[model samples]
Target: MRLTGPVLLVASLTLGLGCSAAQAAESGSSSPTPSTTVTIPPDTTDSGGLSPEEVQRQVARAEILRQQILATSDDMAAAMTKVEEAAKKANAALQAYSEASTEGRDAREKAKTQADIADALQERLDQARSELREWAVSAYTQGGPLAEQLGYLDALSKEASEASNPLQDLNYLTDNRIRSVDDIRQVAVAQKLASMNAEAELGKAEAAEAKAKKAKLKAQGFVQQQQSALDELRTAHAEHVTEAGPLAGLLLGTGDADAIAASERLTDALAASNVSIKDLRLTPCTDASGVFPNGQIPPSNLCPMVGSSDEFLVPDAAAAFNAMSKAYAKDSGQLLCVTDGYRSYAEQVAVKAARGPWAATPGTSEHGLGRAVDLCGGVQDYSAPAHLWLVQNAALFGWFHPDWAAQGGRLPEPWHWEYAG
Candidate 1:
């Protein structure tokens, strides 16, 4: 069956849920969801094919896909609800139609029986009239209209002339007239009841059948629309996944930080001012991965560092380290080995478990703040060539061999290095 106007509109809107950079479905409206613009940082020149604009573009694209997924989810839920409601209505209508059909069938059968009874009563009344007509004619032939319209006694005598008893003659005449009139009245009443039962019941049955058919059609149309929506949703998700890889650097950074400082700043600002999110201050993300658990850590001075490890350091330190590493690699024909660079709180706990008393407690470690590294060359022995080179010329690179780590100092660690930057 053909779909109605309102059902067609729902189908069209379900098909229109796609956007250029985003996807959203407006209930009862066919307008498209608009794309949002974001300003990304300029390229850091050395980023491995991941320029700021490229990253931001990818992020915005992903956001659009995210919106579509959410919209589709809502669409799926609503479709299911519509189908359910439609099914419910259809079931009720079908039940009503069934009841009406049965009632109509029973009513028709009763009407047919009443019609037969009415015919029989009519035949008997006709026979009684014929008998009376003969008597009326006899009365007119014997006398005239005057004699025919005379006393009941005279009429009775003519009707029951062959009766042996006078009382019997009168009783026979009276009974015939009374019984014939009652039969005529019964036939008319029965005919009227039969017509009411057949005609009224037939109309009800037809109307109920039409209502049930309409409800069934509506449910079927909704199911078809839902299936089409599901197909579109799957295709959109595949495209979203295919394009999300450009949002990060060449590699994912393992650096992790507590974000306590940023959290504290957020709390303090909220106490001082009403701290509207639209005008909130942000700190550069402390994590090398450039991600916070949620959007909870707003954007701050993010110093993305470019290197083979794909790690980010504090901005000044990361730039200086990059320069220093390039110089060092130039001289030695290989970069300095890093056993560990930045450690998240969880990583610190793991390291502490593996190296008792040697690993700093989680929050106290400088690595959590993206400022420390542990060297793996013979630098751990304090006498490696890599350490010797840094001792003499590392000052120019903003790196230093700290005093606390010097020989004979308390808790001396030969492999540790901190960036002054």
Candidate 2:
């Protein structure tokens, strides 16, 4: 039925609805409505078209991606911190190496300086040893105690070289070695003094030897000179004795035995008259020319007492008297008179009794030896010009007057001399 009117239509729709329901019953209730139109707007939330469970799963996945990004940033920050720490460590090592290098260089320089000082000390020691050796050798050559002492010093030097401690070595050199050096100096000074003294002694010895030699030579020369003088005197004496032989016999009355006998018999008359006579009396009365006699009484014969005969004096006495007389005459035009010559032993006894012991005994008298003479001036005054002339020139005839105190029994007689020859 075609439902046209409203009531009619209602009745038809009911019928149709019943048929559609039978047909909808035949299809599944889960099928999509084809005649119904369902419309939806665009989704504003992040779930888009998903269900609640799907929306929840998408939120969880997004949360996981955010956690991964955070973890990566943390790793990068850790790497940066590690790089800063490494840089700091490298800087600290460089600073430590620089300090170590500087200290090592200083140590090396110090060691070098100490070595140089040690070397200098060694050289000084060596030089000192050499000098000591030389000095020791010289002392040994000289031969004495100094040589022995120097040997000891050399040994000490060698011992000092082997010492380990530097300070100990220095102490040995200063106190012991230097002291030894001082000792050597003192010895040298002492030796010099001794040498000077020895030289002085040697000089004195040489001078003494020279002086002794000179004295010996002078004494020898004097002896030779005296020998010549003695020879000349002896020759002159011999010549005088030979020339007076004849005169001596005439004076002694040897040529007239009768006259001599008569004279002997007139002894008392001669003695009473105090006639002066030599031991050998002259025959008759005579002067130099034997032609005159003086009447005046003669003095006592002192010559006979002395034991000397005029004959003993003979020519020597005559020659000497004549020579003196000639010199006196030539110089002063005056004559020298001879008053006495020699005497006998009896005469000396008489003189001794009269003049005391100062006179010589008979034989000991110089007059007995015929070596004496007594002279007189022809005029008065024994100090006359002729007497003075005789005194000045008598020594030329080898004559000398004894001193006044030595004249036996006579007073000082300036005109007397003994022939020294």
Candidate 3:
């Protein structure tokens, strides 16, 4: 029987015989041959019914493919670095936009307050001038200052006849007329200053609004650039997968012992780079239309995990998580349990409503970006063995507990983890 793919890896490594056991079995042996009883095959012999020259060529081809895979891995690493830089730029732009927007709002409120103060001052100046004009008209009608003063006093006494304190009202009216006439020029100057200040504040508010709009546009441009970089990276990955897939198939299907050995080496190298044969068969996520602003990514745009929980994440993150989960299972004798992954926009809205301040706002969560997960099965407790193990090793798989989820954080959550890539 011809073994293939991962089973070949297991059979060779688990038995510690490489492909020799399979070779021996194919030779029509009745029972398993002991190492002591084994005889060396001829140097000219090649297993899988191939000539020695053909086997050598297959082995050479496999080595070439392995080298190509390493080159592709380097390309991917470079691409990932670019993606990270783009993300940083995008974040900086967003922060600028947020600060500009806040300043714009504050400036607008300041302008409104200043305008209201200016309007009140203008009204006060008008009222003072109107009273001064009436006083002047009374002085002209009465024919002299002394006569006008006596006339005003008589008018006031008539108005205060029903007052609770007629003497006090008369005294206040006499003091107010002198102060109003003296303060008229000061009120006019104050209103002019206020109007000028209001205009300045209005100009500042408009400038702030323009700055906010520019910041928003810059932030949007950065986001689009980041998305384009990601798309390019995905395209490069798909191309590499296409090239590596057939090479792997050609090497493994040949069943030549030397070729199989070389194929196994290629597999090991792929694993070392956090890649798998299955990756070569996966559908690339290329369509990112309408799946931005966090969350709202379609299922077809993400990679689904193996568990029944229906958890999913972005392609690179999902692959890392899968590799990490497998390692955890091997070391701990149990699969890593995930409580949450890749939240849709609608799901995020529901989560926000249900959890209130404990949950991130909709469209702003890292989970919405398909790079975070909430894990359980002893991983939720900071003191648990599983959590301890993760602390020691998760970063090796590109998963990390963010500082916000660390102990003593503002809202510590030991279960939350995110993919760095």
Candidate 4:
């Protein structure tokens, strides 16, 4: 011991200084000093030769790197979720826009259909109005006072064209307006033209009836005008003939003057009888003037008694026939028909011989008495109304139908009536 205190003090200083150096190194303030005798152990597998503070620093750095990795993973997840949400939103928007476009197209198609219907309706209305106008013009030309009425019809047709439908508009017109205007116009120009033709036919029928009535009236007037002239001629002839019959009887010596006067009286009585003679004539038997003073001969050879020097009816029996006709006419509005008034005795004899048993002998025939007359009604047929009237009424005229039943070998003669005179 070199002096124990000095030695102890130095050792203590050295140790303290060594410890101070180590602390400085640990604190990273300075490097460690190399020592030959002091052995530092080689770094082993179990322990990295690091201080406690360094280890704690290394652990903190590793923790920080792991936290960085976790943060990156969280960020990636968030980004993927955002991309998926955005894609769903875009698809939804696309679907909505497509539906809206389809609805718009459908609405446009419906509008086009409505427009087409409106166009067709308008065309029909125009055609109907044009036809109506043509009809109105035709009615005006047919010469009625309906020209102004036709103008009104044209106005109505214009109004109808303005309407949405013309056929429906036709119902709005009144009955008289339709008949006098629209109906008349359509018929006037129709294919058959039946309405106008019917009116013309009616007019013709009325004119024909008027003409027939006028002709009938003219015929009746002519018949009435001639009645008086016929009556005057008949009266004059009867007076002149009455004086000749008896003078002829005296000249022929068939009777005395008194006898002739008596016969004359009988003739006068017969003339005065209730009879109507439509016509009568007398002629002398001959042209010998002095043979009978009052006798007047007819100036013709047609009389059968013209050569006889005696007075006679022109056919020798005309006086009795005249008297008979007068009686019949006085009792009825009808006149007798002298279908066969007189016959010469020779002619009668010739007829009898020609007809054999069917004809009467000359003097025996009732026709020689000149009391029979035939009759005819105004018409041609011999039907019941005329025949029954004659049968029921002829007896009041002092006339009888000798052939009432067609008996006694005589033909039925509906017109034959004999005066009892």
Candidate number achieving the greatest lDDT relative to the actual structure: 3
Candidates arranged by lDDT, highest first? 3, 1, 2, 4
Q: Which ten residues in a row have the lowest lDDT in candidate 2?
A: 273-282
TM-score of model 3 (CA atoms): 0.49
lDDT of 3 at 362: 95
Residue lDDT tens for model 1, 1-421 = 2333432343344223222112221232365355633333234222223445643544454455445545655655665465445433433333343344445545555556655665665676677668667766875687424532344446456655543554654577667667766765675576566555556655655665565455445434543443344455445444433332221111121011112222222223222221111111123334344433211222253354434454445655566666666666666766666676666677778888998887787666766666666776677877778876555435444455555666786778878876643
Error of 1 at 198 (Å): 4.3
Please, what are the lDDT tens digits per residue for candidate 3 over residues 9-54? 5434433442454466456556655753545455423343344676
> Which is the better candidate, 1 or 4, if ranked by lDDT?
1
Model 3 residue 217 CA deviation in Å? 4.0
The deviation in Å at residue 67 for candidate 4 is 99
Q: lDDT for each of the candidates?
A: 0.49, 0.42, 0.67, 0.40
TM-score of 2: 0.25
Error of 1 at 43 (Å): 16
* TM-score leader: 3
> Model 3: how far is 166 from its true place, Å?
21
Ranked by TM-score, top first? 3, 1, 2, 4
Show where candidate 3 strays beyond 4 Å: 1-59, 144-178, 221-225, 272-421
lDDT of 2 by residue, 1-421 (tens): 1212332343345345434544554454566577854343223122222334543443343334334334433543454344334323322332233234334434444545544554554555556667777756764776424644455556576656563554554466447647667655655555455445445544544554454444334433333333333344344333323322222222123213332232232222222222111111122122322111111113221212112233234344445545555555555554555555665566667767887865666566655545565555542244566654444345433344555522252565555556532
Model 4, TM vs. native: 0.21
Q: Which structure is stronger by TM-score: 3 or 4?
A: 3
